[model samples]
Target chain A: MQLDVSHISIQYQDNVVVDDVSFQLAPASLAAIVGPNGAGKSSLLKGILGIHPLKKGNVYFNGQTLSSVRPHIAYVPQRESVDWDFPATVLDVVLMGRYPHLNWWKRYRSIDFNIARKSLEQVNLIDLADRQIAQLSGGQQQRVFLARALAQEASIYFMDEPFAGVDAATEKNIVSVLKELQAGGKSIMVVHHDLQTIRSYFSSILLLNKKVIAFGPTDEVFTPERIQQTYQRESLLL
Target chain B: MVESLWADANARTVIVCTLLLNSAAALIGCFTYLQKKSLTGDAVSHSILPGIAIAFLFSGVKDLWVILPGAFLTGGLSLLSIEYILRHSKLKQDTAIALVLSVFFAVGVVLLSYIQHHGNGNQSGLDSFLLGKAAALLSADIPLYFSVAFVVVFSVLLFYRPFMLISFDRSFALSIGIAAHRWQQVMVVLSVLAIVIGIQAVGVVLMSAMLITPAVAARYWSHRLPVVLLLAVLFNMIASVMGIIISYKYPSMPTGPWIVVCISSIAVLSFFIGNAKGILRRSSLTVQK
Candidate 1:
């Protein structure tokens, strides 16, 4: 599926948070959205997914609006975005991924549970399927969210800061999952902060500063000049 | 005394009515607690007072059916006004709640005082709504309580999944095509309905306690939503029965305040001795480690 975003702008009251940003991604690619704080990286991602109302823009997945392809789109929000103390087992959270497939009259089927369990296995949390979400460590909680997205079986994935507060081992696990998704012909977009691992982890980069500063393949767009321009800094070492 | 209490028709009616009201309150309280809008109940309960007074002044009678609609309208309006203030001003949610609560409640007090001074003799027992007179609940009021409880319980069963999803993660629920805003409205309406039905039995002042105390106690016992809801209902029902017995044995005691007292005592006990998250259990685990 082709992901297209055109002329998206988001404003909060008087402040223009994201301005006329446009980008497109080919199918089966791992892309990172990198920017300085307050650059609207997260806001842009949410606007495209229709989670945040855009001041002006349109997002298309495979030549269709988001509502038409919502079932095939998955989102992994920031780990800090949810109340971790909620009363839910790990498996229960993962099963929520299958909710889109079921209607009001339908309950979770055997296949849904199987898929949820398999997703948990993929993230190495199968052992803690019945454990409460509040008991999980920071890395485990991030993995729980990743496992939920996997259970969604979506063709395209949008993740916001999945690697923010995790250990190195968990980071390695997430990168492998991203590569696995790409290998399976799925598109993955992430809000990433680390500049050092950008080349190794992503095939493309969208350098942003309230606008599209540069967006292209990592080899071409991940230049020091573009990084400096995006962050508006001087004499930075990478 | 227990056997005679069961044998009396009025006592039976009060017991059944309190049970239904408390059960419904406990069920919806779990969602409010999860949404972190526990105080919404308090605000709505207090805000409904003016509505009741207005309904009585216009209708010239204190019929539960006539006053309930007015109560619901104002209760719903109170929530909307809170939302409006939050959207339009720089005030925070707690401030909005407190503002709406006090203003509406004051209007209600003024209206009630006016009716007492100038209105006809039909407004005699209207002040019972302030502190609640559960024993005064006639058998005629049973059908209304039954219908409201039916609506509350049935709506919960029907929208269980969507309600849980929205309470836990609203954005994710919307992403999955859950119509999160509509479900949120449903939650708000249900909360208003629950408060409206409960104000007569529990009174506006103590109604929020009926909603929140059981839910808070239940949270310490389980780490799953279904279990938490069940435990809350159980705790509420137990307290209701205990309160009824105590009030029955002492004829002068009011049922609503005693019910609140019983639930609060249970909550304190649960705080210390509940299964997993209680203080005693955690301390013991640390000692073992």
Candidate 2:
């Protein structure tokens, strides 16, 4: 699938958070959106997904408006945004991924449950299916969310800060999952903050600072000068 | 003693009414508790008093159909005011809740008094709405309670998945095209109806207690939404039955207060002795560690 974000601008109360940002990604690509604090990276992703209202712009998936192909797009929100103590099991959260496919009054079929189980196995959390969500570790929680996105069976995945507070093992697991998803021909865009791991983990980088500063392959765009320009500082990149 | 209470026709009617009322309340209460809107329950219930009083002032009778719509109007207005104050003013949600609660309750008190002094003798039972008189509930009122209970439970079942999704993660629910705003509006109407339905048996002063206590007690025992909902309804029925028995045996006691007292005691017990999440369990687990 081809994902295109055209001239997207997001504003809040007269303040422009993301301004005229545009990018495109082909299938089987892992792109990292790297930015400094307050760079509106998360807002830009949400705007593209139509979760956050866009001041102006259009998001096209496979050359059609995103709404026209809603089921093909999946989102993994920031872990901090979720209520940890919510009364749901791991399977319950993953099963919610199938809600869009089910009819209003329809209950989940055996096929849906099988898919959820497979997604959990992909994330290596099949053993914890019945555990309460709050009982999971931070990394486990992130994996659970990843499993939910996997169960969505989407071609394009948008993840917001999936590695915010995860441990090293969880991070490694997530990267491996991303590689597997890429191998399966899915396009994944992640809002990443870690500067140290960007080159090794992502095939493409969209360096942003409230705008599209640089967007291309990692080797071509992840230069020291562009990093300095994006963060608006010299010492941090040093 | 239990058999005697069950054998009396009037006592049986009160028991049946309370059982239905509490079950409806507990069903709606689970979602409000999950959303952390228990205080909103209290605010809306208190706000309904003036609506009931005004309805009586206009209709010159305390008819169930007439008063319920009036209560919904005032309850809805109170919720709107709370939202408006939270948005436009610097006050926090709790402060907004408190401000709306006291003002509306005061207005309700004034209206109740005005009716008592000025209105015709039909207004005699208006004061009973403050602290409900379960004894005064006639056998004819059973079907009304039954229908209210049916609607509350049926709507909850009909919208279970959407309601659960929205209450836990609203933005995610909205992202998936779940029509969160409509579900939220439906929730408010259902909650208001729960309060209105209980007014005769568990008056305005104590209605919110019924809405929160059962759910709070249930939370200590379960970590799944469905289980919590079922437990809440079960606890609510138990409390209502116990309250009915107590109030009947002691002819001077009111049903609403006893119902609240029973549920609060249940909540207190659950807080201390509940499985998994209870205080005792935590303390013991730490000691074992």
Return the top candidate by lDDT: 1
In order, what lDDT does every prediction score?
A: 0.88, 0.88
Backbone clash pairs in model 1 (N, Cα, C under 3 Å; residues 3+ apart or in different chains), count: 0
Off by over 4 Å in 2: A233-238, B138-141, B283-289
Model 1 scores a TM of 0.96
Task: Give per-candidate clash totals.
Answer: 0, 0
Cα shift from native, residue A43, model 1 (Å): 1.4
Q: Show model 1 residue runs off by greater than 4 Å.
A: A233-238, B283-289
RMSD of every candidate to native, in Å, equals 2.3, 2.4
lDDT of 1 by residue, B210-248 (tens): 889998999989889999989898998998888788877
Instruction: Give the range where candidate 2 chain B is weakest over 10 consecutive residues by summed lDDT.
Output: B280-289
Where does candidate 2 clash, by residue pair? none
DockQ of each: 0.52, 0.45
**Tens-place lDDT digits, model 2, residues B1-289:** 8799888877877787788788889999999988999999999999999999999999998878788889989989999999999988889999999999999999999999999889788987778788887877756667877898789989988989998988987767766777788999999899999999898888999999998999899988888888889989999898888777787778778788988998999999999988856788766432100
lDDT tens digits by residue: candidate 2, A1-238: 7988889899987799999998889888999999888899888877887777899888888899877888888889899887878889899999988887897679999999999999999888899898888788889999989998888899989899999999898899899999998999999999998999998899999999899999999999999989988988535656
Q: After superposition, how far is residue B188 of candidate 2 from its true place, in Å?
A: 1.5
